[model samples]
Target: MLDFRMDTFLAVCQYMNYTRAAEALNITQPAVSQHIRWLEEQYEAPLFTYANKRLSLTREGELLRSMALTVKHDEQMLRRRLHDPGPGAHRLVFGVTPTVGMSLIPEPLARYHRLYPDAPISIRVSNTESLCAALDQGELDFAIVEGYFCKSDYDSLLYRREPYLAVCGAEYQFEREPKVLSDLLGETLVVREPGSGNREIIRRALSRENRAVEDFRSVIQVSDMNVLKKLLLLGCGVGFLYQAAAQPQLGQGLLRAIPLEDFQESHDITFLWRKGSVFAQRYRQLFELLSPQDIEGESCAAGD
Candidate 1:
């Protein structure tokens, strides 16, 4: 179990206000202060500083916050397994970015479900940033994300390297062979919403040409992957997405991939779990179910 003092400290860190933390913890404000003072004395370092009427973690406080998070997760995991162990006793909660959720994870999740029909599963699909936040809060067991994140915070495995492609309606006629960013910039561009992995990937790729998404002639931001694909198919705009995601339309002669000189690159789809998770080894079988090589190899075969 996490220490009550540590929990009190975390509440303060979260709210950054002594009164608010106290109210949330159902404790008195002075008691909250006492707990913090005790913690500071034990650690022999001030954990927070009040400057300009704002509370902020000092460098030492930041270190303690990190350690506290790990300790909290360890305690939660221990309590969960201890309280619930036996047939059909565990609930697995995980997260995924929209791109991975739509294209890569369905089959493996289904297989896992079949194998452990009694173990309830909860999946949260959101942007990479949101997914990582949930993992940080210990709301998820793990997450599968695309684009880039702070890999140092978790234990991760590269599940797949998926290529991003420039796509358009099959009937849309290009003025010229698409060779550069300029060729596509004049057309309306459909892109993922901010914080989405696909949008982040496109943003970084555009920076190589000293451009940004705002440089496009017109931009359409769609939060749902299905809606984005629908817009592209209806010729609402040219879009960027994983090649495997566009495969179905490309095969049906309803969509065509426009080759880009600079944006032709792949990003990693990674599986992330809390660092030093007690359940890490226990969940290895889940990783085996979502193997990137196996998933993509089969996708390629189907495409061929």
Candidate 2:
């Protein structure tokens, strides 16, 4: 079970405003203050500072926040594992970033269902950061993510390495024989929202070229995969994504890939779960079933 006071403190950290936190928790602002005061008394240190109408976590607050999150996660996991699966019922909760959710999970999920037809599976699809936050809250048994995360905190396995390509509508014209990062300066860019794995990969690659998102002529940040693809097909802007994501469009000649001259961005897709989780065995089985090589091979065979 999770502690109410800890939950209140976490809400405060998340929103960074006492009133907002109170509203979120459906508690009075003074009650929220009372909980913080109680925690401060126990910990013997101030957890937050109020200055210039801004709220910031004190050093002690930061440490408590981390510990409280860990305790909450551990408690959730213990409760889950202690509960019986029940006769002929196997339940699971998992998450994935958009890219992996779109490309990789379907086949394995299908196979898993075939093995345990009566089992119920819950799937959550979001960006890397949100998925990671859900994992910390113990809402997911495991996750597949496409962006950078704190590898030290989880037991992670490399799922695959995928190339990120610059693509645009097939009918769109380039200024010249565009090949490098600099050649993209004048193109409107369709990008993923902040905290996206794809966005992080693009940001790192741009940094290497001494460029940034602002260097583009224009930027359109989209969170929905379908909308982003529609924008690309409509010739709204150039986009960056995993090769797998844009492959079908490229094959249909609806889009064209522009290889970066002397510059290609690649990111690792990884399977992640909490450190020392009891679900490690179950996750390993899933990893073996959904390994990129096996999935890719099956895809190729199906295409044939």
Candidate 3:
């Protein structure tokens, strides 16, 4: 078990103010200072510093914060494990990007339910950054994400490799048939908001060409996948998405592919959890149960 003072440390990390941390922990401001001082003494380093009058973590502090967060999450899981009423007492908590949640979740969830029909499950759909933060905070057991994440901070299993696609409405036509994205630079670009995995993927791809989403005549950011697809199908604008996500619509000729000569790109959809999670083996088992088939796109088993 970790020292209870880690709670105070995390609170300070959250609020960045001793007074607020103390108030949240129902302790005095001086007590919060003492807790921090004690931790600094034990760790033999200052954990925080002020720059431009704003409190921020020191290198040592960042390292401690990462380790402490894992401890906190592990403690929470330990409590849940100890007090669990039996099978299905605790819902299986996990997250997925909107693309995966929309296209890949149902079949695997059905498979899980068939195997353990009484098990409760909770699914959170959000962008990659938010999902990773939730995993660090112990709010989620795992995530299926398609964006960039710090490989050093998490353990991952390669879920699938999905090709990126640029699409417009079936009736929409580019002025030059868009052999490259340069031909479509004048059209509006419909994209997911910041922190979304697919959006980041395209952003990096564009940067390689000395361009950006801003290079488009206009840009519309939508968090809802359905609305984004509707806008595309209505010829409102062009959008980039994973092939799996657009498979049904493309097959139906609702969304037409714009084969940008520059965009021969694909991204890995990964199953992510904390680097040193106590429940890693258990999560790996669940990954196996869901990984073999059931997803609509191509997939293969990945090593730990």
Q: Could you give me the TM-score of model 1 versus the true structure?
A: 0.84
Query: How many angstroms is residue 37 displaced in model 3 relative to the true structure, after the best TM-score fit?
Result: 1.2
lDDT of 3 at 6: 84
Best by lDDT: 3
Model 1: CA > 4 A from native: 11-34, 49-56, 74-85, 88-90, 292-304
Off by over 4 Å in 3: 1-4, 15-29, 52-54, 87-91, 292-304
Task: Give the winner by TM-score: 1 or 2.
Answer: 1
lDDT of 1 by residue, 94-142 (tens): 8888878887888877777787777767899999888877776777777
Query: Number of clashing pairs, model 2?
Result: 0
Model 2, span 96-155: residue lDDT tens: 888888887777778778878877788998998998899888788788899888754567
Tens-place lDDT per residue, model 3, 29-141, is 99998999999999999999988978999999988988888777777767766766685654478999999899877788888888777776889999999998898887888
1 versus 3: better TM-score goes to: 3
TM-score of 3: 0.88
